[model samples]
Target: PRLLKAIEQRMEQAQLRYEISGQPARVFSEFLYSTLKTWSRPRRVIAKAEHIGKANPRFVVTSLPQFDVDWKDDVTVLDAKHLYEKVYCARGEMENRIKEQQLDLFADRTSTHWLKSNQLRLWLASMGYVLLNEVRRIGLKGTKLAGAYCGTIREKLLKIGARISISASRSRYRPRIRGRSCSVWSGSGSEFLKHRPISLTPLI
Candidate 1:
């Protein structure tokens, strides 16, 4: 009840309100000092009340002093909104990237009984994700799959159905793409493949 009342009071007296970029919500932020029963001293707290259709309030307690402290020449002073939106929100984005790696690149797969082997597996998965990200950055530029997820790219491009013929001199890949998929490949696929040593022979 106390927390709710505090949030409501802050919302009522909100003086700093701004719209976050690329988000439909309005955020109001304020700084206050409060202490929990288990704490020895009052700490600086940042209260952020977000409103889209309904009120959504959040609080963050930090050991960092109030924003009024004098800064050195090279130091940067962080305000409440900057701390919450820039620092905290960026941390959340980093967590999303970690989740993407775990989901798309099988980073969470550690079935090996040995600890060293599991560590090596995780390292390999991380390396694979790095390489895939590089490919997306360089090769998939200006394409529909440029901003696509790793799993989507894997399913659409990497796991494409193809007939492979191997001879003593060379190997040939006849892609089994059709309709829009074929069109997409025909447009930019050759440009993408040009960096590699493989040859793309036109099918008669």
Candidate 2:
């Protein structure tokens, strides 16, 4: 009941401020509170009070000592906003990396009955993901696929289906590509893998 009342009052104030300034208003505050049954020991609770189109109040309970101090000035609000944005929102990026591994590299394929085989499969998948990630980070620098996921790189480069015909004098690697015509990279067979043109025009 106390928390609800506090949130409602903050929303009312935020709404008034929004109407006056014609912009969204927010309030950041922290207080020490305790549960009636579970955690009687009081803990610090941070609240983000805001009114965009409606009431939008967010709360986070933390054990950080920096937030323990009373926040009354602009410097304290800045610090709290930075801490909340950095410490809490960074989990989203971490989750993105995990999703990339699972979806792109098949990291969740652990249905085998044997534990050893499942472990080996997961290990190999992780290693493969790391290797490709490094290739994007180092080898594919300044390329279109540098910031691309593993699955995209595989589709664009590795999965190219080219019909090769070689003669004694020279070799020609002709790959039938979709869309309009592309500039043929005519070079020795050995130079094919060694050098990639700056253009990321798909090889099909």
Index of the highest-lDDT prediction: 2
Clashing pairs in 1: none
- Per-residue lDDT value at 172 in model 1: 100
Residues forming the 10-long window of minimal summed lDDT in candidate 2: 180-189
For model 1, what is the C-alpha lDDT against the true structure? 0.72
Q: Give TM-scores for every candidate, taking all chains together and pairing residue i with residue i.
A: 0.66, 0.52
The regions of model 2 sitting more than 4 angstroms off are: 1-29, 33-42, 47-58, 67-79, 139-146, 166-204
Relative to the unseen true structure, what is the Cα RMSD of model 2? Answer: 9.9
> For residues 65-157, could you state the per-residue lDDT of candidate 1 as single tens digits?
444444554555677788888877899889987987899999999998999989998998899889778667766777787787888778877
Per-model root-mean-square deviation over C-alphas: 8.0, 9.9
Residue 120 lDDT in model 1?
90
TM-score of 1: 0.66
List candidate 1 segments past 4 Å from native: 7-23, 33-40, 66-72, 142-144, 165-171, 178-204
Q: How many clashes show up in model 1? A: 0
Worst 10-residue lDDT window, candidate 1: 15-24
Global fold similarity of model 2 (TM-score)? 0.52
Residue by residue across 1-204, what tens digits does model 2's lDDT show?
677575777778888999899899987777787888999699877777888978888878888766334555333433456556777668767788888888888989999999999999889889988987866666566556668888987776556678888899988886765531122122222334665667767779
